[model samples]
Target: MTRSVPQRRTLAAAAALAVACTAGAALSTAPAPPASAASPASPAPSASAAAGTASGYATENGGTTGGEGGATVRAGTGTQIHQALCSRAGTDTPLTIEVEGTVNHGNTSKVSGDSCDTAEDKIELKRISNVTIIGVGGGAVFDQVGIHIRESRNIIIRNVTVQNVRKSGSPTSNGGDAIGMEKDVSNVWVDHTTLRASGGEDEGYDGLFDLKNNTRYVTLSYSVLRDSGRGGLVGSSESDRSNGYLTYHHNLYRNIDSRTPLLRGGEAHMYNNHYVDVHESGINSRAGARAKVDSNYFQDSRNVLGTFYTNEAGYWEVSGNVYDNLTWSTPGDKTNPAGPDPESTTSVDIPYGYQLDDARCVPDIVSRTAGAGTGLGESDGRC
Candidate 1:
């Protein structure tokens, strides 16, 4: 039935209870014990939801945050965010838009594509540079709106949750993507954010965070991506070799099906992340793509890391990765082996200096710090 992660979790608990009841009614009636009672409760979200959001999270990239020296602007709701970006869409000046509470896209259409079009379809960050868009306070959520980036550079988006950005439910709707970028976008840092959806294409959901058409120098860190069919990508197509040099670190990717990201002809450093309950695949490093897969934890996943689902091959230098209960099959010499395996291929030297969290500590560190609204903030796993 393709139950979602939350749904499956609830169902599994119920099933366990039913089993317990069958064994002994008194056992099922007893108050349930707290799961992992010995583990400490995670600290409060201490990262300021204001202008510092980017700086707080982007420190993972050696302080190369694009919005490091930008002005700050506070905003709430979708219209304000859209208008703020549109106002500076064609400018080169820096601006920081601080978002609070929730924003809605109004389920518009024709934000991107051509012809059968409407003006209110997309909230495009177009032709802008040196910007920081951050979430502040309790929670910041962009609901049911595709946030598009185009011809933009030097941007930092942190501590925001983009979810259910589907459109008015039509064949031509160009919304649905939680976040997307294309056309010469560069030097973007997306951190401590949550990009999610309930279902796949049938529900009008697209990529959580997709990069395309020469976008480069990007980093996605300390984030949570889940419950969508396509997680994300590096290049837009088979010919997109120009867009590369990305880093994905300390993120929690759960309940996704594929593209965990489908890297195409780009160099990506994917390390210290956690992939859980990925149904079909994860990290499809394909189309001449080179990936440095290091020290990630993958649990209850199938084909969690590999060169797969296409004829074109990809290269990976994997080391210190922990594959717990990961399922795989040999597809004609294209074997996806989860480690504790020695690196068999040439290692791709990452340009920046960073620490590799012990594979055993990934789940603890990531669970404590990754994603928005974590009490301890994005404080852990910084460079």
Candidate 2:
């Protein structure tokens, strides 16, 4: 079976063994070691000592801190446990926080808990820089964001699985956005992660990942976004004047039905991806943004290429693709065999290339279809 990110609620409760630190005198009393540990390590130096010393683990009130401080926190049974870890990092050193095992939160009764309040983001990276949060072999889950990076830079979140991220029990608030990078963050790379959300009352905002306004130089690759109520991956400009650049490549997306509108921003490149069982459209480019969708595979997807309702002088090169078990939103009338609806026509050229008999629909675009062949007829024409 295909692997998916775990639900936030489940992770919050089950993965609650990690350690946490808070600001102020609370540091005087460290929490107990996880049940699995034979003997936990002592806490790092006191906040004052850390600040004055030249050692790597220094403390700062609000300014930035440098050097790598390795901290391993167990995923405990609630958001409180996760929050403690974020707080203990003291917003200083570019912490390399590693997590292992399962964590659960929101719901009560360690054994028989239901969905608790959304897990309030397992780790909140706020106004910090140069941090790397990595997860090893053991799986981890979060009810909200596995990692919420806000107003930070030079951050890398890799090799993690963030499943079932929801805001609240209410349908309007039930979006399982696994990773949310918001508030003018830049230089971020989210790679090799799997995000999944399923069976929630709310479908409008169920995205596997999202990058908001004032975001630039961001890359998402080699990830899986599936079984969500919303889109697999999304990016948006919070304001009309704000600029954003995003690159989404080599990912697998399946069964995403969220209704949050597609992004319309500066520049976006989406290429060499696989899409399957999508509810609305496989890939949507809206709001006048310039996007290049090429060399991808689309199987049993709804609207293969939807450039409907865009304003930002868009351009698309739809070529060298194999279309099998694919349906267009607007199949052409008898008069127009090519199905170029007047509304669908743009300054760009979207030409038909090849149709393969295999189960996969590989596009004929040079950048997109070079990696995977749909076993359809070969295309002599360049994309």
Candidate 3:
């Protein structure tokens, strides 16, 4: 892929995003065990049955192995999902829940148990570990609801769609975040999922994917986050700076206003992603945060990278990115634009090895392989 003209404002060096694809062979839908049979014998691990693998930062901090070597269950409603978790013998008991239908407020309710801390109006995975929730069959949609993860670890959510969750105006879930994690979360891999909202906070929608309160070791890959005011955030506020160690790649962010994630404090690697129609700002790295932005494709966006809305600036290392039809805003009290021309302000050393797809192929590659469907597909690891 032909790279844009390199522009340097500080140190003169070229960088390319080294991002790895996080996908396993697609899983096939198996017949569901009855709800009462919560721990059905696990199917033999195969390309079609094994839980998806973890990559990126999820491969760190002891790694994320959600529900591996555990029993598998099928859930068609929200209640059953909660029941499946509650049925586990303990918080760390491995279990996989394959969902196959709509999971919403009407069909979901809290099920109390020693193993789970749940609530109504949302699908909660709280105070737990070693769990996987994957969509199969016709697929799983959490419409007008959200998936909330709190104080949890070693969790994987794949091939699911969460949309239109509201924090106000009647029904609300996960504080209007389609997928939210907070309070000591660790080692989570969310892949091949779709998270979206209709409008901004004024329209009752919040972030599509948000993390806060010391959450760490998370990766979001091969997914789509679109049509919302806020894509997501790492820390809740400037003071909430404990969260860190994130990786986002092979994803699509389209028609969003800002915060392709607003990082507060931590290190993040963003690569091989596609951004389109980012109306306001994108990738707001602020409050002493540091980001390695590489080999990404940004088109028809404005202020696609930099610290924003704060005087406490974040830093970024930029390389091998394509910017087409994007506009830059003037630097102001709380507005800092990274381009019309971008350069590295800092340097980061990634602990993991990754592949770099040329920025030229990113838009086409991410479009075909991202989101809840397409059978959890992946690129060929080639340009």
Candidate 4:
């Protein structure tokens, strides 16, 4: 994004933020970005912008091919999927598990008050490594169920629709997410998937994709996160800040309240995504979290960036983003930028090679390329 204004005081403000965070004045930082950070339109990427391809950071982290060269196994039942996971030869052997039809977990698991025997309710991808769970063709639905990944590595979930994970209004049931990961999980790529809900938190729904408790090296590309109270969380708790090294790009986030992915104490790279009708908040980086926000399209959203509600200081470096018909509020700290915003940002070291769509073309490109069942056809998700 080209800037017409001069950037002189941006680094000074960042230094001040570093000092404030170190001095412990910040309890939890979640501030909104200043109005000056974005223009009505953004500049498109140059001839050489890199987009994160399937072979990119989102998948195959450090040459870890999850089920890349394995035998294909198709499962028609939810129980069969679980059985396949438990029957894998080893943690490093690759296996491609294709799921078909509507796999319902309600038969095995039921929610009681605030607790759910998720042991019976979820397709728990536990104690497994180097696995890729993909939908077979156009229709594989996980209804009222969750995909829980724990203590695993080198996993990929693609071309699936996870929706309406109802557990009788219990946020604690089934880990409260469509796709949830925790407990030392690493190297996950969720691509071309749909994680959604018809109702909000008042109706008992939770996050779309959540990673917590030391989960790292994750990327979510060409996905849809919408119609829910929470989008996702990087670190689950305030003290659980060691998790996060996540990437979100070329995705669509619509009709949401907050945390279009709440990041707490970790580094996140968010770029080339479309955010629409965000009612309350978005991209809440808090508790010493750092976000590199670049080349996004925000339409009819409010407080789409920065820290809010918490006093813990969050840091953001923003560039090449477009804000059209966006709404903002001057509330508290960590949500609002003080002076001239950074036209550029501190470099985040990512180890993959890819292409980047120009910021100005994000709205049109993302609408066509994001979500499940679209884009470059390969899991690559090129715009």
The Cα local distance difference test for each model comes to 0.68, 0.45, 0.84, 0.68
- TM-scores of all models? 0.78, 0.59, 0.88, 0.78
Clashes of each: 6, 54, 1, 24
Candidate 4 lDDT tens digits, 237-315:
7888988778898788999898887888888888778998887778887888888787777777777886766788677
lDDT (Cα, tens digit) per residue for candidate 3, span 16-56: 32343322222224222122212222332222543677878
Question: If candidate 4 were superposed on the true structure by all CA atoms, what would the RMSD be?
Answer: 11.7
Candidate number with the higher TM-score (1 or 3)? 3
For residues 1-383, write the lDDT of model 1, one tens digit per residue. 12212112235433432431111111123333232423332443333433443321233334445445555666776566655555553366566777777766453322332211124655567766777777767778877766788887778777788887664464222545788888998778888889998888777788898988988778888899999988998787788878788889889999998988989997888888999999887888888888888777788887776766567888788876666666664554444433223254556877555656656567776887788766425423221
Which candidate leads the pack in TM-score? 3
lDDT of 4 at 32: 23
Model 2: per-residue lDDT, tens digit, 1-383?
21211112125322321323111111123332223211111222122211111100011122122224434343334443334334443444444444444543442122211211123424555676755554443434444444666777666655466677666643222233567767677767665567777644353335667667565556665567777766533454324424345656556677776322255555555555667676655555545555555445555655555543343333344543333355454422211111122133333321211122111222222222121111111222222
Candidate 1, residue 15: the lDDT equals: 49
Candidate 1 structure, TM-score to reference = 0.78
Q: Give me the displacement of residue 176 in model 3, in angstroms.
A: 1.1
Q: Candidate 4 lDDT (Cα, whole model)?
A: 0.68
Q: Which residue pairs clash in candidate 1?
A: 44-375, 45-375, 49-136, 111-121, 111-122, 165-176
**Runs in model 3 with CA error above 4 Å?**
1-50
